[model samples]
Target: MSTSTAPARRSTALPASPIRLTVGGILRSEWIKLRSLRSTVWAYAVVFALQVAIGLLVVSVTVSNTGETFRGGPGANIPELATLGATAGVIFGQLVVSVLGVLVISGEYSTGQIRSSFAAVPKRLPVLWAKLAVFGVTTFVVSLVSILIAFFVTYPILSNANITADLWDPNVFLKLVGAAGYLALSGMLALGIGAILRSTAGGIAAALGLLLVVPIVFGLIPADWSATISDWLPGNAGTAIYQSSRIFEWWQGLLIMLGWIAVAIAAAATLMRRRDA
Candidate 1:
């Protein structure tokens, strides 16, 4: 005798997203995630404190020294040097910022939180965009505030050395703002690298290499091509944006940096769409 077997029951599949996506919703989610992280809090606090402290120190030295004393020479006073000192900490603080950017995403991948994130928002690209928006805007605002404080506070001290600049001047204000922009874009670039590599170490190394190591290696390579290409790199081009002297024009530097950010992020989106969580 054959026994009839009842049909096995199956659970119904849910829609990819239960909640509707609005700009506000995505932004709120990203903001919550970003603020919840202790590392993000610490890194940003350190960045502001470290960069401002360096600016103060630089200007203090400016008040104390004669022409080119710090650079080890007797020469005419270089006005540009003062502004350079005002923003000098950025060159160093950027390293910390870049590491944080990499960790922002790679930490998720490592901890397997990314899968949960994808499970929540199956469309994926919105999450990436939201992350970029939240991080980029936050970084830009903080950086702008920090750099401006550095500029204003240091200006008076540097004035004692006859190194002064008016913020109204196109070159000066632009660079001051551009310094913040550079930091924001640099962070995004690191984020893109982090997305692509999906590893904290690899992402940080790639970002730092682009920001720090490539220039050094290229600088050491005894070839004009190396020098030319190096000058166009994100680090070098970006530096020109905020420097007292222009290497590439401000527009040129800005355009070059935007190009780098776009390419990296685009490549990341491509991989992210195809890859498994």
Candidate 2:
């Protein structure tokens, strides 16, 4: 029986081309994902508005204080305080942005969307890099723009109080940039904590503990080591970037802050690799 089986029917569907994972592709995907979330939009808007509004409030307070000092005599040299009010909003902004950072990753984990992400990326680390890159760039740009807006708006108000600072001045410019950088690094640290914890509440709590509470607790302790450690806490180091009276130089403060960020990211990456999605 020389019966030949009929040729198998050909698939009308085209063979799927393998999707190549590139850094650019990953970054674009992350950007779209970040922008699509309504929470992301609200979070960023609130952060920018709150920061600028708080900066205005700080300038008003400073104006009130300066009037009394001017009445008494020539006010003390508070050149540092001249630009301080403009950037003061970053204090509140950092907290808000950090929370957003935590939500960025933890939200994914909580929703079980992370499995699809891991499946797509496969290697895993690319997703982390993409999130950090997209989030960090977004954070820095938003923070810098909002802070600068506050800075310019504060100029006329503060100038009337004889507290004007030239933006062209190196110190003024550096401090402004430093403030923005501080928020970026702070956000990155928060994201890393989120990745490690994979819970929004836990991530925020740990981040707040590290950035706010731990330093205060250490300060309350009387030991010399406690004082030294407190001086070098991430929050303190971040403040040093803008505060001239700090123990460490600005560059040193920046390095210290960067070190904290690096360590946090390393820990997060390690945990991310070992943990189950």
Q: What does the lDDT read for residue 222 in candidate 2?
A: 96
What TM-score quantifies how close candidate 1 is to the native fold?
0.86
Candidate with maximal lDDT: 2
Task: After the best TM-score superposition of candidate 2, give how far the Cα of residue 46 lies from its true spot, in angstroms.
Answer: 2.1
Q: Which residue pairs clash in candidate 1?
A: none
Per-prediction TM-score to the true structure, in the order listed: 0.86, 0.89
Question: 98-166 in candidate 1: lDDT tens per residue?
Answer: 888888889989999999888888988888899888998988888888887888888777666666667
RMSD of each: 4.9, 4.2
Candidate lDDT scores, in order, read: 0.82, 0.84
| lDDT tens digits by residue: candidate 2, 14-124 | 576566789999999999999999978887887778767888888888678767563223554444666676688877888888888998899999999999999999889
